[model samples]
Target: MKGQGKRSICVSLVALTFASALAACSSNSSSGTQNGTAGTAAGTTADASKEHRTLTVEVFDRGKPGQPDLNNNFWTKYINDNFGKQFNATVNFVSVPRAQEVDKLNVLMASGQAPDISFTYTQGVVYNYVQQGGLAELDSVLKQYGPTLTKYLGDDVLKYGKFNGKQFSIPGKRTVLAGSNTFIRKDWLDKLGLPVPTTPEQFYDTMVAFKEKNPGNVSGVIPYGFSLQPSNPGLNYIPEAFKPSSLTEEQFATLQPQSIWLTNWNMPGFDKAVQYMNKMYNAGLISPNFATDKDGKLLDADISNGKVGAFQTNWDGPYRTAPGTYANLAKNVPGAQLIPIDPWQNDAGKHPKNVYSPNGMYIIIPKTSKNVDLAIQYLNWMADPKVTLFLQNGQEGVDYNMVNDVPKQTGTTNSGDKMMTVANNLDYDILSNGIELGDQQKNTAAISAGYPGYEKDVENALKVGMVDSYTTYYYSLPNAADAKSNTELKNLSAQMLAKLIVAKPAEVDSLYKTLVQQYMSQGGQAVQDEYIKNYKAQNGK
Candidate 1:
């Protein structure tokens, strides 16, 4: 009833805005629909009038098996049937490979051929385009066509889209901000007569015990699961816990966190973290081939096989059904009690970690598009609470059933109405990610109800992950040094950290010193200096 009320209001707003826009149109130039194809350049001025135009939106193609094509799925058709029909536009979806999205997007952007609606996780790439005058300024367009979008995203999330006092993008809202949540085998703890670890030291002891005792009774039991993906090392899982308690805001801001600071090698006590990791490596308490576990799928296998004792990942890592870590573990090792826990405490006795900044992908309309108005409208349509609920949960009693207030997923075997296997078809819900049911209680309840057998565990994982989480420093302005060298610096950091983690315990301090010097020499100092300078200018601190 609450969602329904909100939905009616939003739907009215959408219709009213569309009517007003359609009434004031100057022309109607028609372009036929292009389904799931690459975007071509289109005029931004006269064609933006009231036109039956082909609006090409970009979507990720993971090439997953059994899933519908990204272009012609039930969801895509639903989008066209609803939003596309309303605007008299043919909505075409362009597929960008998920693994090489940035590279593919770059190729498309450089030739002025990006999709009408495109987005990326990296702000630096967007910033580069902004500096080059390659993006459209959406402030006036958004105000005229995207009133509901403005209210839905609000200033908080909208700020990420703004560049040089102009709204250049719409940042997708992230419901849960927590970055990394750690999961441990409760059954193993029960067998070993050990408590859930509460401190870093205790966690280390627990890992040592896990290694020695083999509490799971599995051969090659990895006490800690880790990954060294060059692009996404994921700091919150490891070195960030060693972040000094006395870390100043200035120091934190200078850490170059947007992309390259993935490993957190720049943190004050980073060497100590590496040393601790080295200790884990020597004791054989960590994954033996972590350096090779790029993309984290290998770590997932270890987790599913019940070989991992404890691991850290995105808040809902183990819960998702595909590559279903929790579900697989349940079937493979019966009584496998994997539960979320917060054990790795920082120096301040806080489980401090970098949470998301209430935003996921940076949604942008490239300057090459004539469909800025349509683009804004399409996003607003998705932002409508009704559209959001239907997209996420699907039709009641068909794909899901309402138990209390939340929609719990049921059998979705009906091919015509089946939901995308990807947790919530997140790729299509371009304006938002993670479930947001208007309130925190409903959100938690919905998450609990969705994953039937591991309902409570997933709920606790989310709550625990959020306990001491905080968003990383966000600069309204882009850093040039970051744009230029983030890829190089991140790769370097991942490689250096991986090596340091495998180095002998005694060699850690000196090796870390050498790596820091090398890192600083190779544009790291420039990034830090520029960051600190900008920090002071912005904060006046």
Candidate 2:
């Protein structure tokens, strides 16, 4: 239940595991990643990179097999040589379990056992620390020591870290912010003589066609891939086209957020959206047991096995090679064509999807830390253009090669320093998310190259996902009601939503009403009301 608002805890795990999924929601992209290396090249502070004795930063133990140690690895050694020795400080990395980072960091900060620099994606963690006055105010330190850092992160991204005007965290800058994209089997469409779906009605008819035609010729064809997890991107977005577009600011603020955790049953068109989904489910247009595929493995497996005709997933998912959904599909089914499409549009004629906020992790320097100055200096150094480039692509011609001026990653290197386990070596470049070329065109080309043959598909997905996309809203103050009841309420939302989706047509409305009623009684109303209060109080602050 950590970080459910904006991008949920599941979304973070999606980034850590199926990085392709992160590509859709990320401005933390690959191209502009190196842009930070130049970091506007403005180190205006008198002693920006001053000498210090020691510095500590937290890194995630991503639990990937054969992955280098988070604390000490080739990348860490490179950092030590390039940045650490120059500052006369030994940079130490403290590893926190990725899946349990928020909980672990809470304990660490409370016990004064945290690193000099740490971060969390969970807003509740930041709120807890701010409430306890355990986080250092970074406003002055950033102005005095992190000019380039501030410029790169910009006002919009940095604002996410401010609470009541106190800058308690440094939000990592993400340059692009696209989100989920839906894909259809181009070959199936051709076989069935159906053009791409345009409206919600057309889209549903298309799914029905996908089922009735048996174009894939599989024993049990899955017209659409789905997962019932609260974090499901399709579950979060595909139906969002049904949300009313003319919501006033206050209503949007109160309801749009935390939709994944609390469910947007109260939203005007949400019930209709769920009812349509129930119709699809009863007709067997979706995976029969989608509820069991919490981690997306089973659904992904279905897609890779060439049984799923159409589906939605994090942008660039099918294009990537890791899980290689597209690759496996190509190998299994000859002439299978999976292409990105923005089919469902609301009455306003827009494909409403959730784009990422232009921020990544909320990095902090705890008040308990003695190395505040050094920590700020270290982070500032990280924002350096050259440093950002190194952290992202490693040595040119070793870790990567220049293709049309883009750094193309060459697999594992002979030396450890140039090698990487995670794609884009995101672990090493904690400050940046995906690749960043100088501009969108270059960025698209760079990302396209990463996907090999599916370059066009990747580009299409990115473009389609961005059309009329709404960036996740960040609250300046945390909702205590949400933080307190989110765990219980999130599970309830997921359970009831599954029932609403799978129930008979006649039961859909009654089930949805029950969901909203039970949700309100079981702490939903408190969360909603407290969130509104916080939103109104912090409206223009």
* Per-residue lDDT of 409 in model 1: 73
lDDT of candidate 2 at residue 405, scale 0 to 100: 79
Please state every model's RMSD to the true fold in angstroms: 9.0, 7.2
lDDT of 2 at 309: 85
Please give, for residues 497-516, the per-residue lDDT of candidate 2 as tens digits. Answer: 78888888987877778778
Question: lDDT of all the models against the reference?
Answer: 0.73, 0.72
| Candidate 2 regions with alpha-carbon error over 4 angstroms | 1-41, 44-52, 67-72, 230-234, 259-262, 413-418
| Candidate 1 per-residue lDDT over residues 102-204, each given as its tens digit | 7777767766678889998877677767876667789888877777777877888999888766888899988776565778999999999999998888999
Q: List the residue pairs that clash in candidate 1.
A: none
RMSD of 1: 9.0
Q: Which ten residues in a row have the lowest lDDT in candidate 1?
A: 1-10
